[model samples]
Target: MSEIEQLLRPELRGRTPYGAPQLDVDVRLNTNESSYPVPDAVVRAVSAELADELSGLNRYPDREFTALRTALADYLATQAGVSFDPEQLWAGNGSNEVLQHLVQAFGGPERTALGFTPAYSMHPIITETLGTRWVDGQRDAQTFDLTVESAVEQAGEVDPNLVFLCSPNNPTGSALPFEVIEAMLDAAPRALVVVDEAYAEFARPGTPTALSLLADHPRLVVTRTMSKAFTLAGGRLGYLAAAPGIIDALRLVRLPYHLSTPTQTVARIALEHADLLLETVEAIKAQRDRIVAELTALGLAPVPSDANFVLFGGLADAPATWQALLDDGVLVRDVGIAHHLRVTAGTPQETSRFLAAMSRLVPAHMMTKENP
Candidate 1:
């Protein structure tokens, strides 16, 4: 073994870092990012905010990120109808860092972190990297649904120290039933339950957020990111809402002055112009529905989605179809599912190009039988 490899932690010796391909293609939809660019007004506002803070770079940023936390709390109150005191909010470089902080605080040697399978891959990565045991629970084999019964049963069996629940889950693009969250809190009474809502802004109408349950459930934490709907992925700001006591626990593990002055300024300014920034949500949602409808019409089975992307099956070979689409200048995700691929709901033009590419590939790449 190489010197560095030999010195590395045994668990991380052969592990690859988490990343989706950042390919340069005509219609890139692999990652569930906003296809729309930041509006000119918000760009101008961020530029101004950063310009004003340039001189302050010499000093350390606010260790607590007070103003950003308040702005986030305000945004949550307005967007989700859940009021939160600033003390109930915490943020980090991205939701990933916030998640790591949670693992560091609650999960460590001999402790266990449990999550339903085919959910966020990072849940286990973060858990195991922190020396926590990872329990891979199951979802419905065909439908990928996690019922309250299944969740409670798994939690009771694993007795984990942390449990991850992803709403509008990645790879499948489906939201968890609310009852599952409640059942998890009850079943895993000793565990902290984290609901990753990175795509919450794109959920269909009438879908409820776990934020409403935070008041009564001290173990519940809902994480949201500016990377998806906020069109601020470059800003690298993600925050979560939980009981103030849980928030305090995270503070114990976070590095001092974690949020830079510029990062704090940019996020606060973006939150200030949230309405303008998020105006394209309906447009994106329209494209997401179009993808589902059109892919299904093409004889693929797209799981009903509440997020900004669609996961469709029925490919003869997902990797082959992925390459065919890539050759035609459209990029989608091959999420390691044998017969399935995922495409982000991009701008209308991008969606049209992706659909057109799929249409042309149907004769050779689409599954002929009902089940491939």
Candidate 2:
């Protein structure tokens, strides 16, 4: 082993860091980022907020981030139809940081964190790297569905200290049945159940958010980000809603002035102009459904999606098809599933480029019933 490798923490010694390919392609739809740019008015507001805060850079940011939390609470009340007090809100660099806070405070040596496989890849990475045992729970092999029965059973079996659940789950692009969230809370009574709702704004009508259950479930947490629907991926703001007690616990683990003045200003101002910023959500959803339809018509199988991406299958070789798409000036995610790839819903033009590339590769690159 190399000197650095030998000196690394034993658990992280050989693990690859989590990232998607950042290639230069005409249609870059690998990461599930909003393909839209910030609206001009929202940009100007953020700029103004930052300009006012620039003089205060020498002073540390508000350790409590009081105003940002209030803005976040108001946004949630408006968007989710669920009310929250500022005391119940927490913000960090990204949802990833909020998630890490959960682990750092509640998960550690000898503790266990559990998540169903093929969900967010970061759940396992974050859990294991923080000196916690990661239990790779299962979802249905054929449909990628997590039944309430299956989740309850696994949570009961592992008895983990933290459980990670993603709604409109990453890679699969489908929301968990809301029942699964409730069942998991009961199944793992001791575990803090975290629902990562990074794409909540893009959910199809009638989809429920865990935020609604936060009033009754103290152990429940729903994390959201400005990166996707808000079109502020560069702003690096993610926040969560949980019981006040859970929010209190996170403060114990967070660094002093963790939310910088600029980050706070950008996110708060973006929240104020959320309606203008989210104008593209419906357009992106249209493209998401279109990708599902087109992929299906081309004889590929796409999981119905509630998020701003589609996970399609029937590839003869996923990595080869990913390369083929990239070669055609488009890029998609080969999410390590045997014959499936995930593609983010981008602008209509980008969607056309990706579907055209996929259509060209079909029959040659796709799996037929005979192949299966």
Candidate 3:
């Protein structure tokens, strides 16, 4: 092995960093980022907040980040229809960081974490990198469904110290049924259950959030980010709602003053004008539904989605279809699934471009019974 490889942590050596291809393209949908930009009014407010903080950059940001946490609690109360105290909340650079803080506190060399496969890729990365053993759980092979029976069985079998669950799960683009979450908690009695709700704002109507279950479930954690529906991906703000005790545990692992002044200011201002900032949500959801309907009409199988992206299958060759779309100036994610690619919902015009590109490639790249 090379010197640096040898010096790397035994678990980390030969690992690929978690990221999507950040290629410049006309219709980029590889990452599940909001296709809309932040509103000008919110931008101006953020600018004003930052200008006021510049003179105080000499001082470290609030170690507690009290103001930001209060703002986040206010937003969640309105968004999720559930109330939370600021003390019951914790935040970090992104949801990923909050997740890391969780693993660091609960998962270690001899401890284990369990996550269903085809969920967020970062769950495994964070768990393993923190010196915890990772157990690969499963979803249905055909439909990607995690039924409560299956989830309960896996959790009981693993008896892990930590469990990762993704609602509006990544790459699959579907929300987990609340029954599965409750069953998991019951089965893994000793495990801390984390529900990554990064796309919570985009879930379809009638979809219930895990946040509602926190009143009685001390082991439950529900994390959300401003990167998606809030249209503040660059702002790097993510927070979670859990029992006060769980929030206290996260503080033990978080680096002191880890959130900077600017990050706090940007997120808080955006939260203050949350209604205006969230105007594009309906538009994005419209586009997401359109993509699913159109793909299904084209003979591709799209998993029913509650998130802002759609995972479609029936590709004869996923990588080749990915390049074909990129060549047409529309980039989607080839998530390493055998015949599926995940595409983020963008603006109406961008959606048209992606669907048109798919139309051109389908006859050649799609898998049909005769073709197969």
Writing each residue's lDDT as its tens digit, candidate 3 over 199-234 gives 888999999999999998999999989999999888
Q: Residue 295 lDDT in model 3?
A: 95
TM-score list, all predictions: 0.98, 0.98, 0.99
Least accurate stretch of 10 residues (summed lDDT) in model 2? 363-372
Superposed by TM-score, candidate 3 places the C-alpha of residue 247 at a distance from the truth, in angstroms, of 1.4
Candidate 3: misplaced stretches above 4 Å?
Answer: none
lDDT of 2 by residue, 1-372 (tens): 999988898888878988888887788899888888888898888887788879879999899999999999999889889998999999999999999999999999999999998899999988989999999999999999999999988998899999999998998989999999999889998999999999989999999999999998999999999999988888889999999999999999999999998899889888889888889999999999999999999999999999999999998889899888888999889899999999999999999999888889988998876765
Clash totals for all models, in order? 0, 1, 0
Sort by TM-score, top down from the best: 3, 2, 1
Please state every model's RMSD to the true fold in angstroms.
Answer: 1.2, 1.0, 0.8
Model 1 quality (TM-score): 0.98
lDDT of 2: 0.92
Candidate 1: C-alpha lDDT: 0.92
Pairs that collide in candidate 2 are 168-175
